[model samples]
Every structure is written in C-alpha cells, then in structure tokens.
Target chain A: MTESWLRLAPGFFALGALAAWELAVRGFGVPVYILPGPIAIVAAFLTDPGGLGGSLLATLTVTLTALVTSAVLGAALAMAMAASRLARAAILPWAVVLQVTPIVAIAPLVIIWVGDPFASLVVCATIVAFFPVFANTATGLAAGAPEYFDLFRLYGASHRDTLLLLRVPVALPYFLAGLRISGGLALVGAVVAEFVTGSGGFASGLAYRILESGYRLEVARMFAALVLLSLAGIVINLALGAFGAAVLRARDGP
Target chain B: MLDIVSVERRFARGVVALEDVTLRLEEGNFLALLGPSGCGKSTLLRLIAGLDRPDGGRLTWDRGRAPAAGEIGFVFQDATLLPWASAADNVFLPLRLRHVSRAEAMPAVHDALARVGLAGFESARPRELSGGMRMRVSIARALVTRPLLLLMDEPFAALDEFTRHGLQADLVALWREIGCTIVFVTHSIYEAAFVAQRVVLMTPRPGRIFREIVSTLTPGPDLRLDPGYATLVTSISKTMAAVLAPA
Candidate 1:
C-alpha cells in the first residue's frame, strides 16, 4: 500500500492543486477576467474546441517537422565531425554560435528570409534543437573504447565499417538522450516562432490563439489554450521518452 | 611459425617499451608472456599482431608472406564485445567484416559459441552475462575467425580466481582442439604455469626476455594440484621477483 501511495503521489498532488485552485476561485468570487478557474477553463474549452483543436494540430505539425529535421541534420553533422578534424573545426563552432544566439532574436530574420511561415518556424526550431544532438553524439563517438577500435582494426574493418558498427552503437544512448531534450526545445522554438511571425491565417497555432484571446480579454479561453499548449509539451516529452527508452533498451538485447 | 629477430620498439615520448626482444613461436604452441605491468609485454603483443610496428628488427613468417589481415585474432584485457550486439553477432564480427552474409556466417558463429560453452546464449547481450561468461564470448569471438595466431592481453586478469582457473582450463582445451599458436600476456605466475607450454619472463622498462621455461607436466584438470605444477609456478615466481627487484 505504501509503494502504491508513493507511485500515485504525483497524480494526487496535481489533483489536489487543481481542487484547491477551483475552490479558491469560487470561494473568493474571483472574476473570470482576472483569473479563470479550472472549471471556467473547461467551460471555455467545451464552448468551441474546434478552433483550439485546429491550433493544436498546426503547432504539433511544426514541432514534429522541426524535431525530425534537427535529428537527421544533427546526427549527420556529428558523424562528419567524428570522421574528420577539418569538418569539426570548420563547422562545429558555427553550430555552437547558432545555439548560443537567442532563437527569438533569430525568429524575425528567419521569417523574413524564408518568407514561408511554416518553413521559417521549422528553421528556427531546428536551430534550437540541433546543438544538443550534435554535441552529445560527437562526445559519444569520440569516447569509444580504444581496445574495441584495435579489435576492429585487427579484423581489417574499413573506416565505414568502424563508424557504422562500432561508433554508432556506442553513440546511441547519448543520441537518444539528446533527442528527448531536443523534442521539448523543438516545441518551444515552434511557439516562439509562431508568436514572432504573427501570421494571421486559418492555420495559426496556439500561440496566435493566446495572443488573440488576450487582446479580446477572453481570459477563460486564453487559459484553455494555455492548458492545451502545456498538454502538447507534456505529450511530446512523453512520446520522446518512450522512443529513447525503446532504443537504449536495445543494449540489453531483447 | 613466426620469427621475431631482435625487435626493438621505443615510443616517441622516449619510453623504451622493448629492447632487442627476440623470440620464435612454433605454430599451435601455447606461450605466455609473463611480466609486471609497464614491462612492454602488451607492446610486444601489439607488434606480433601488427597493430604496431617496431622501430627496429624484422618479423618473418614460415609461409614467407606477411600474415594477412584475417590471419590474426586478438583478445584485449577486457571482453570488448559490442554492448548492443548479441553473443552471436559479436562472434560473427570478423567474418562480417570480411563481407560474409549473416545467414552464411550463422553456422560458424553458433559453432564458435558452442565451443566456448555458450551454446544457448546466442542471443544474449554482454551485460546479460556474468564476467566469466562475457570472457567466454570474447574467446568465442577470437576463435570464430579460425586465425592461425591468437593473441590475448591479460584476458582473464579481471576475473575472480575460480573463473580465471575455469577459463584457463577451457583455453587449454580450446588450444589443443583448435590448433592455433597463442601468445597470452599475463602478470599471474600460476596462470602462466597452468596455461602455457612455455612461459617467457620479461624484465621491466624496455622489456627484454629474462628467461623462458618449458613446462614438462601435461596440462589437465589435475595439473593445478600436481606437485610439478607448483614447482613450475614457484620457479617462475622467483625469476619474476628478481627482475621486479629495484636495481
């Protein structure tokens, strides 16, 4: 029973906080405009979920696109860095520079240059997500046990063979870890890009819905959109967590 | 047969790892290079495996040709199996590198694992096995290629005594059955005596051979308790101690 209590602790705490919030709003007669209660937010969501759902889908598509792009590009760049010193010295610094520069600051320029709202958001998000994967994978590739390399060389394994068989497996856990972090960063970048672009269209995401709700003083609806955005972030993280666990478990061989 | 005539190796940092190290290895003989750490025993093994080249001296084979890439199999001090691969995949690595398809190599891989007593462990990962079992997988990997020469660098140094002795016996049996020349490097005196037909004692710092003793007692399960085995271990230990003594 104690073990079960410990396992259920987090869920209970979240429920308690929501109940307290709902009671506090109702007990104090807090106006919906100042701070919407949990019940009011649910009422707002039930009023017109079609709009909120569309926004959620739009943001989700951008987030997935950015994440997949960063993963592929980051892994390829890391492999290049591992394979050649010249490539590492030449390109890795630029990647670091992109990582250090604030994505919000880059968002405007990316939007203007790409001229397509969706593509620009993807570019911005990819920049945000790329560094963790690249840096982690490079460290992993370089850290391969020296003795394993000697064994590969003894077998006369080609450079390609060593990279694919030896280094790739060694880098897998690190890469998966980076993927989980990148998944969250990709979502953050997508939202930030959406806010900066301010592209008023039928395909506008949750960021635009939040902005539009704030302007109209629809605090309850704004909270509903905010809740959905939080849910989206949680879903992305959980999905990536599942993926990383599955891949890293391969080390255990079934 | 392989000949190492006066091989000399010195690192660029001016550490003389070997000086005039000369030895001849007869095919199918089990030999141990026994010495303290930093005695260039591993360096010499690397030279034989062609993983490193000597700054001096020549190596010639009986076939009058340099040993081809696939002609040598090396086991490091660690099992060194790919953590993500199954025991069978790890054993099949050398043949895979030679471009043999997995289906074509599965039979030989299974046979190698069976020889190492890992018959039912074809799909097990390195982490799933105990230390002794992992070392057995390493041995199976080394034997899979059927190399003419097998070089092991303290492969059992990390295991407990019981596991070490068990592996030592297995190695001897494998050697007799497989008929490959083995040059095992170890710092253990009894291990050298128990496993090798000839134990070569090496001195520290710019390691050179101090002596080579040939064991007359036949290797068997009873050899560890036999008086002859104890005699050989004592004699080898005394020689090793003298070399390890401060000048």
Candidate 2:
C-alpha cells in the first residue's frame, strides 16, 4: 500500500505546486503579461491546439533527424579512429573545435551557407549531438580485455571479424550511454538553432512560436508553448532511457 | 609438435623476458613449463602460439608451414568469456569467425561443451555460471576448433583447490581422448608434476630452462595415490630451491 502511494507521490506534488501557483497569481492580481496562471495557460492552449501541436511535430522531426544522422556519422568516425592513429590525430581536434564552439555562433553561418531553413537547423543540431557518441565509442572500442585480443590473434581473425565479433559487443554499453546523452542534446540543439533562425525570419517550430508570442504580449500562449517544449524534452529523455535500458538488459542476460 | 630455437625476447629499456630459450616438443606429448612469476613462461607460450614474435629465433612446426589461424588453441589464467553471450555462442566464436552459420556449427559446439562436462548448458551466460563452469566454457571454446597444439597459461590458477583438482583430472582425461600436444605453464610444482609427462623447470629474471625431468605415470585407479608421485614432487621442489640458492 505504501509503495503504491510512493509511486503516486511525484504526481501529487506536481498538482499541489500547480494549485499554489494558480492561487498566488490570482491572490496577488498579477498581470497576465508578467506571469500567467495555470488556468490562463490552459485557456491559451485550448485557443490554438492545432498551431501548438504543429510546432511540436516540427521540432520533433528535426530532433529525430539530427540524432539519427549524428549517431551514424559519429560511430563511423570512431571506427575509423580505432583503425588508425593518423586519422584520430587528424580528425579529433576539428571535432573538438566544432563541439566547443557555440551552436548559436554557428547557426547564422549555417543558415547562410545551406540556404534551406530546415536543413540548416538540422546541421546546427547535428554539431551539438555528434561529439558524445564519437568520444564514448572511441573509449569503448579500446576497452576490450587484452586477453580477448590475443585470443583473436591466435584464431587468425581478420580486422573486420575482430571488429564485428569482439569490439562491437564490448563497446555496446558505451555506445548506448552516448546515445542517451546525445538524445537530450539533439533537442536542445534543435530549439536553439530554431531560435537563431526564427529571428532570421523562418517562422516554423515552437522556438519561433515562443519568440512571436513574447513580442505580441500573449504571455499565456507563450507559457503554453513553453510547457509543450518542456514536455517534449522530458518525453525524449524518458524514451531514450527506456531504449538504452532494454538493450543493456538484453546484453547482460537473464 | 613445435621447436623453439634460441628464442630471445627483450622489452623496452633492454629488460630480458626470455634469453636463449630453446626447446623441442614431440607429437602427442604433454609438457609442463614450470617456473615462478616473471620467469617468461607466458611469453614463451605466446611465442609458440604465434601471438608474439621473438626478437631473435624462430618457431618451426612439424608441418613445414606455420600454423594457420585457428590452428592452435589457448586458454588463459582467467576464464575470458563474452559476458553478454550464451555458452553456445561463446563456444561457436572460432567457427563463426570463419563464417560458419550457428546451425552448421552447432554439432561441433555441442560436442565440445559435452567434452568439457558442461552438456545442456548451451544457453547459460557467463555470470550465471560458477567459476569452474565458466572455465569449462573457456576450455570448450578452445577445443571447438580442434587445434593441433594447446597452449595453457596457468588456466586453473584462480580456482579453488577442490575445483582445481576436479578440472585437472578432467583435463588429463580430455588430453588422452584427443591426443593433442599441450604445453601447460604453471608455477605450482605439484601441478606440473601431476599433469605432465615431461616437466621443464625455468629460472626467473631472464628466463632460461635449468632442468628437464621426464617421467610418465600410467593411467590407472591408483595413479594419484602411487608413492612415486610424492617422490617426484619432492625431488622437483629440491631442484627449484637449488636454482634459487647461491652457487
């Protein structure tokens, strides 16, 4: 019985916090422009559900595309690095520069160069999401036991055979860990890129909606869009977590 | 059957691992490389298995050509199984690397597992097994390829005495059944004496063979209980102590 209640505790706490915010906003008679109450945000959400939903769908598409592209590219580059010391030495510094430099600083140039709003946003997000997968997979590919390497040599396994049979299995947990971090970064990248491009006059996705609502003094609508954005991040993290857990459990056995 | 001809291995800073080491192995003979830690027994084993190249000298096999990949088997001090894979999958690794399908390799895999006394454990993972059972899986994987020579580097040093004794007997039985040449490296004088027909004693710090003893015990119910076994162990210990003492 206590366990069941404990499971519901987070939900209850969230409801209580929401009720307190609503009561405080109404009790203090704060202007909606300054701070909209929960009721007002819900009312704003009901006003334009289609618009909010459309923006959310747009953001999600960019996020997923960026994540998938980074995952493939990052893993391939890591494999190349594993194969050769020269490639690692040549490529790592540039990858580090791209990662450390701000996406905001890069987004404008990307939009100008790419000349396609959606594609530029994706490129920006891909920059944000690529490093974790590459760095983690590189570490994992080298983490196999020395004994296993000798065993492979004794068997006369080719480079491809050793990679597929030994290194890949050994590096799986590390790859999944990188994937989880990159999932969250992908979302952050998409929204930040959208914000930069939104000001450049591409009026698509939730970040644009947030900026437009703020200028128009539609504070409740701004809060509604913000809430959807937060919810999207939460859902993405939880989904990635579930997927990683399932993969590791399968590998670890019954 | 292999020959280690004047093999010399030197590490960085000129630290010698093996010095002027030469030995001849006959077909179907079980040889024990008996030595203390850092005596380069493992290094010698690696050279024999073609995992390491000697700085000087060569390994000449009976076949004129060098052993092909998967032609020689090895078991380490630790049972190194792929923790995520099933026992069957681990055993099938050698064959699978050759592009044999699981269905095609299942018979050899099963036969190897059964030979190791781990029959019906095909689906168990490494973590799910006991220490001895995991070692059994390692042995099964090594034997699945039917290698001509088996090189073991203290393969049972980590197990308990009870498990060690049991596996030792099983190993001898398997050796007799397969009739392959085995070079077993161990620090334990008694293990070397019990398991091998010929014991090659080595000295540490620039490892070189100091003594060689050959004595064969007939397989029978009373082999371990025979009075000669204890005498053999005692005499080998004396020889090892003399090597450690000053001239």
Candidate 1 accuracy as TM-score: 0.93
Residue A105, model 1: lDDT of 91
Cα DockQ of the candidate 2 complex: 0.70
DockQ of each: 0.72, 0.70
B2-104, model 1: which lDDT tens digit per residue?
Answer: 8999999998889899999899999889999998888899999999998899999989889998787778989998999888888999999999999999999
- Per-model TM against the reference: 0.93, 0.93
Worst 10 residues of 2 chain A by lDDT: A196-205
Clash totals for all models, in order? Answer: 0, 0
- Residue lDDT tens for model 2, B107-205: 999999999999999999999999999999999999999988888999999999889888888998999999998999999997888889999999988
Q: How well is candidate 1 docked (DockQ)?
A: 0.72
Local distance difference test, each candidate: 0.90, 0.90
lDDT (Cα, 0-100) at B119 in candidate 1: 100
> What is the Å distance of residue B180 in model 1 from its true position?
1.5
